[model samples]
Target: MSNLVRSELLKIRTTSTWWWLAIGAFLSIAMAFPLNAWLFNTAVEGNAEDVGLTGDAASAPAQAANLYTSGQYLGLMFVMLIGILMVTNEFFHQTATTTFLATPRRTAVIVSKLIAASLLGFVFWLVTTVIDLGAGAIFLTLNDHGTLLGEWEVQRALLLNLMAYAIWTVLGVGIGTLITNQLGAVITASVLYLIGTQVVSVLFFMLSSWLDSLAVLKWQVLWPAVASQVMITPGENEMLPAWWVGVLVLIGYALVSGIIGVLLTRRRDIS
Candidate 1:
């Protein structure tokens, strides 16, 4: 058992893409800085009088932080792909047989890889959040607004954001395990994220609405959309199942993928 874990951990630590993910996370925060500042200073505060708005000025800092974090979230999609490639690439390379031969335990390997991926995901998430939140505070302070980083809602959002990113990382690892081929896993995740999750679903939903002449059954085509919305908003609108439901769905996807991958690996001939 220890050997299996050791081997899996070694593989994860050595994977080149892991470092790239960290770098990308930092880069995402760096790029988002200016945009966050612009939005906080110009739109939220500047446009207030013209738009006849009246809200707490502190909300601008919070909103700026959210926008900054959003950029990091997008970059995490690539990190997920990186994880998938590392986890699934082993099979296509025929290295799993070597790994199993060394450890002779299947489940231990999956557990180790899952743990490592989750840990890496968590570190990236936290670092990105701090970068986004800290930079946002600085930007807001520079504009004559004092720091507002310790708000309850911001902390909650950061926690939820970390969990969301961790779930996606685990899901990506499972997809990698299930597919085996690195390229297949990457293509599948990319499609599910870029096309299936957002563009295709929204377009399909819109088309459905148009065909029904504004009387369409909206709930029928809301899986991906609801899933995304729930993850971001959690219990805000009760629009879909709570964020916990999405978390469960993520776990289910990862578990099923890992199980199937393990079964296949165990049964296949190793020549």
Candidate 2:
């Protein structure tokens, strides 16, 4: 298993895909951090209502937590793409047959890919977290809010953000398994993740309004992307489920994806 994972990692490291995704993630963080900081500042500086933030939602701890976890929206998509590529590449390069024949244990190979993808996700999370913390600290200090690291809310957000990254990557692997065509998988996942989430959110909002129930809004977390956001949301929110609920929703999706991936791969005719 260790050897198989190492082999997979080596494949990733040898390719340009990983670095290109990493660069995209970095640029995403670079653009998002300042914007998030500015929005947080705007909300706190007597215009909280303008941004729909009030009371606890507009507090230093909550805003700082959101700021510190910046770039997660797009970063997770990139991480998921990495996962998709990990599996699709095998089929794309016509290496799936070779890989399965060499190992003979399809389950082991799948597990190894899962591990490798998770590690890549962790690396992405680490890089973005470091960048967020550095910039967050500076921005907070200049704005007189401090780092807010001492607060449990901020810490929890960061921890959950890591979980989000790992889970999304695994989900990506599942997506790849389901869609073997590399280009199709990438385009589908990217569109569904980036655009689908927005469309879904809007639909949910319309539904909630039509039904005139705030409870309907909570259902939005069922979407993986929204779950990721909810999981890292600090403090209490009436319109969303608890942070732990978001974690469970995401875990449930990842588990379903993994099980399906393994079952499909075990029976798949690579030849």
Candidate 3:
């Protein structure tokens, strides 16, 4: 059991993809520093509404969470790539056959990959989260708008956002394992989670505006549902489901995908 986890971790360490993804995640999160500075500076100058935040919405804590979480969502794309690579690499390089021969139990291999992906994803999240919040705090303090480092809501949001990144990695593993075609899996997962959801949300919004009967579909979009769970902020509309509901919806995807991936790995003849 321990050996499986170790092997998976070793697999990750031996690869260059992990480091490159890590660097990308860091840079992606770091972009928030300057953007946050601008937002806070403008809000402090009484232009909060210009930034789409008003009243207490322009508070330091609120802005800080927004900045930090904005990076988190952006960094998710890289983390998703990381997760996709973790499993697909084995197949791409024709290493899965040897890996299964050594372990014999395909379930163990899948479980190991899942566990390792989670840990790796968590590390990515931790690094980006630290950099994001740290940079935001420094910039906010320097700008005299104060910092939200000690705010409970911001802290909670940070934690949830980190969990969301990790969850995406797990989801990536499931998708990668199920699809197997490296490029296809990556593109499919990206489109489904990233672009597909946004398209659905936008279309739903448009339809709802034109015909109120379609308003119920607004809460059913995949990405926004998950976003509501992971984000500490409210959705752009009031129709999205509750946070817990989103969590369950995401978990449903993870569980179903993981199961199907495992079943396919067990049944498919890996030549």
Highest-lDDT candidate: 2
TM-score of 1: 0.77
Rank ordering of all candidates by lDDT, starting from the highest? 2, 3, 1
The CA lDDT at 113 in model 2 is 93
Candidate 1: what lDDT? 0.62
lDDT of 1 by residue, 59-173 (tens): 5644544554655545557667756865776777778777777766666666776777677678778777767766766666777666655665456556767776776677677
Ranking by TM-score: 2, 3, 1
TM-score of each: 0.77, 0.97, 0.88
- Write model 2 residue lDDT over 1-271, tens digit each, in one string: 9999999999999999989999899989988998889878888787988887777678878889989988888899999999999999999999998898789999999999999999989999999999999999999998887788999989988998999999999999999999999999999999998899999989999998999998899999999888888888765556878888889999999999988999999999877
Model 1 residue 234 lDDT score: 22
Candidate 1 stretches with Cα past 4 Å from truth are: 1-3, 46-65, 68-70, 207-229, 238-245
Which residue pairs collide, candidate 3? none
Question: Model 3, range 107-209, lDDT digits (tens) per residue?
Answer: 8888888888788878887877777767777777777767767887678678777667777777888888878899998888777766776687678777777
lDDT values, one for every candidate: 0.62, 0.90, 0.74
How much RMSD separates candidate 1 from the native structure? 4.3
Which scores greater on lDDT, model 2 or model 3? 2
Per-model root-mean-square deviation over C-alphas: 4.3, 1.1, 2.6
